[model samples]
Target: MFSIPLVILVPSAYGRMLLRLANTVKERSDIHLQIFAAGNDWPLEKVKEMTEAGIYKGFKPFEQLKSDFQQADAFLTVMSFEKAEEPFMKTSFTTKWLDYVPYGKPVFVWAPDYSTAYQFAHQHRAGIAVSEDDPVALVKAMIDAASNLETWQAACGGARKAAETVLNAEKIHTLFVDRVNHVCRQSQDTPNIDDLKELAR
Candidate 1:
């Protein structure tokens, strides 16, 4: 059985989605999804239910989580399709992306088309992106990723390139400095204090 580890935070918002995917995969494939619930938001009842059902693998500390990642075949992350989350999901990137990329393991993203997760996967080709909310589609994506070594290798290579280029700290710092300098240059022609006081009056 291929073990795919997922570290999920804020279970109140994402727990159901993860359950749906896990149940579907359980019914359809030999994939074993080991869910490590992080944060304090997970309700005890839900955790108990999933734990008994063999879906929830309990929480791991940072060191243990890193060890699990090293042992796992791949990684998974998701964005909720709930309408209330759309605005935030569209603009925000998951930190899990950063966490998984460094491992060079296949990162499977199940998210809506508008989500940053999907966009990042599409942009960098760093992971498999299943834009649809269908569990079957997500299952197919996972199966494809597991079966095709060349595809995942290429994706991992793209992830490496992204880490080396756009995600590089030095490059980002340079960009920030350049932008600040441009803004300072533009502000050079701004009105003096007396002109500002007159305008306020």
Candidate 2:
């Protein structure tokens, strides 16, 4: 197979900024961050120095995005939560989880609430969910997950399992069929307002 030079993990600027916030913790933490950005050239070396002793490597954005999740040994994600008055936080899902599907690597999520991804992770045992401001929690989770190879591999298996539950052509077809059936049922059951008013009067 043709292997590329490197994998580029390209998230939006908002995500990058969120990630930077995690780096505010003391350096030499268990979690190490690698950057692959094509936007304004910030001093990523600062990130490298803070995390992995200046081992900042990269390729293109697309490739890095893949390796960052899939081939990456692990991941740290920033997640939001579902508030009572507010809607579920958008960042709670982190589409990056989709990229990690191929590698089946375990993820360390930094989220503020119990979200869909958090539920998915627990359901499939695919990753560790942490509080967004808890960098210590993220690092500790990453370290523990890394140390347990069997557990990590199982998480990968679980990730693939999660995908199979939703990604198969047959599964999609079944969902479409079910949705159409429900819609048809609803249409049949929808009451005619005018007819009801006339009958009542």
Candidate 3:
């Protein structure tokens, strides 16, 4: 008797892909998707067309993101259509997941097992990760999340903690500054052209 509607916030580029995964649950009556995308990739007319055809409920503007996020139950983060064997899928992490974490929302990650993004979801326990190889697995993940409300709530809290500890912007900046300072010190310690010439002799 899960009554909360599952609202998934997805970029237009990812909305369709996620729909493929959601086909199993789209008509469930308790699930809804609010897709927002911008830029030349998704024109206004195209957005309208997708909705009219019932591809999704509709497209929203980026302006509505924060308000929409506040209303939504969960977030979605997906990778490109490539399968597990693709080289890029093995190492790349979708930054969208990090964005979702800071919101303290439960996320459903659709990525290959080899993807670092999938690994992060598992390691942090911030969200559920579904294997891209099995579409049914994705659907099952969604249903399980809906049924296990308490566990998902805890995951949301974990998401916020993981964001602060592992993906903090200030922490990243400090690491970058440290690397730059180390590089400068190494350059200063290196011999000048005259010293190099003498050593060669």
Candidate 3 lDDT tens digits, 1-201: 222222344544355565564455545565555444432234556556545645444445445556767676777666655643357767666766655666777787777767777878888886788866565777677677888879788878878887898877678789999999999999999989898999999
Top candidate, metric lDDT: 1
Candidate 1's TM-score: 0.79
**For candidate 2, lDDT tens digit of each residue in 9-87?**
4345434444554354335554445544443233666555533543244345565365445445665555443254124
Positional deviation of 196 in candidate 3, in angstroms? 2.3
| Top-TM-score structure, candidate number | 1
Off by over 4 Å in 3: 1-16, 22-25, 39-49, 53-64, 81-85
**lDDT tens digits by residue: candidate 1, 1-201:** 578888877555677778777667655446878788764344677667667767688767877799888888788889989899999998988887766777777888889999998998888787788888887888888788778888878767766776677666577789999999999988997889899999999
TM-score of candidate 3 relative to the true fold: 0.75
Candidate 3 overall lDDT versus native: 0.65
CA deviation > 4 Å runs, candidate 2: 1-17, 20-32, 35-64, 67-70, 81-95, 166-173, 188-191
Candidate 1: where is the Cα deviation over 4 Å? 27-29, 39-46, 52-54, 169-195, 198-201
Worst 10 residues of 1 by lDDT: 38-47
Compare candidates 2 and 3 on lDDT and give the better one.
3
Candidate 1 total steric clashes: 0
- Taken over the whole model, the C-alpha lDDT of each candidate is 0.79, 0.55, 0.65
Better of 1 and 3 by TM-score: 1
